[model samples]
Target: MRIKALALAATSALLLTACSDSPSDTDIQAALQPRLEGASCVTAAMFKSFPVTLGSTFSTGVSSGNAPAFDALTDAGLLAKSDKTYSLTDPGRAAYVEQASGFCYSQGYEIAKIKDISPNTGPMGAAVDKSWIVTVDIRQKPIAAWAKTPAIEKLARNPENLSDVPKTYHVTVGRVKGEQGLKLIDPRFSIMRGVSVSQGY
Candidate 1:
């Protein structure tokens, strides 16, 4: 009789354990798909900074000296350059994947795949006027336990991305109208990247 009771308790515990695990793919997608609404960008660059941070948007007129770093990113093919104009390109996302992969690798995350692409426009007073949305599928490195650190925790909490329902970044790239190009607008990801932002959209 004692053995049977122990067995019954173990079975119930297993069932409860399975129920409390991470969310399913369907749940994650359902949570993620709705937030994709915004301005349409030609390339992935516009949303690169889609949820424009107040730090980048509102300034005290102090320079952080990262302009040349952005220039280097353009030179490295991460950003699209056409006729002396630069914007975010698919390659830029790839470069960012490589960059993020390095950090995530330590936490057992890897660059897996990018699923859907969403493009949209922003509100009249929104910081980013135009944007591109990306759904990235990231997987954990097998055999490594990813202990969620502060960065991982922060990424998990961004409601624009997954709402802790999914484990990947719902990213965006911001864009702007171009001064000189066959393309009406180029992703504004450079020092000259604020023509659209300045428009108060």
Candidate 2:
């Protein structure tokens, strides 16, 4: 009788332990997909810093009283929420990388280093206007080849080779007049790079 009781207790404990463990991959996937597809970016101002949240939206200036459009992300498991210190999950990072890759290919450009981008100016009037000052190591060889080819230059120089996002983007060329080495400017990156501009969304 004593042995049977001990066995029963052990079985119950195992069941409870299994229940409390991290969600399965299928569960994580289900939670991540929709949020990634329709992710939105909230400004760091919405929170105290990079990953800190100020209690709730009432304390911050975030619109919609939520973390902008990516609100669904946390529940989806793509975004981890530990008492408001949100961080991207592994799946979330993969999604970001994929999006960045697509944007690079679309613009006839590539991102040699994601960290190289930063805001030339501070945050703008709205929460989303903040942009990064991108330093594009111009693929001169490919561009030069295209220039030599017939009719490519005209198509490349067309005004349509720009984006139409709401935020402002800037670029730091390798060298420009009135500066040395790399020169930063108050330019729009999405337009100059001919890619979709987004704060994060």
Mind giving the per-residue lDDT tens digits that candidate 1 earns over 113-145? 566545534442344344545566654333111
Worst 10 residues of 1 by lDDT: 189-198
Off by over 4 Å in 1: 1-108, 124-129, 142-168, 176-201
Report lDDT per candidate.
0.35, 0.36
TM-scores for all candidates?
A: 0.22, 0.22
Give the least accurate 10-residue stretch of model 2, judged by summed lDDT: 138-147
lDDT of 1: 0.35
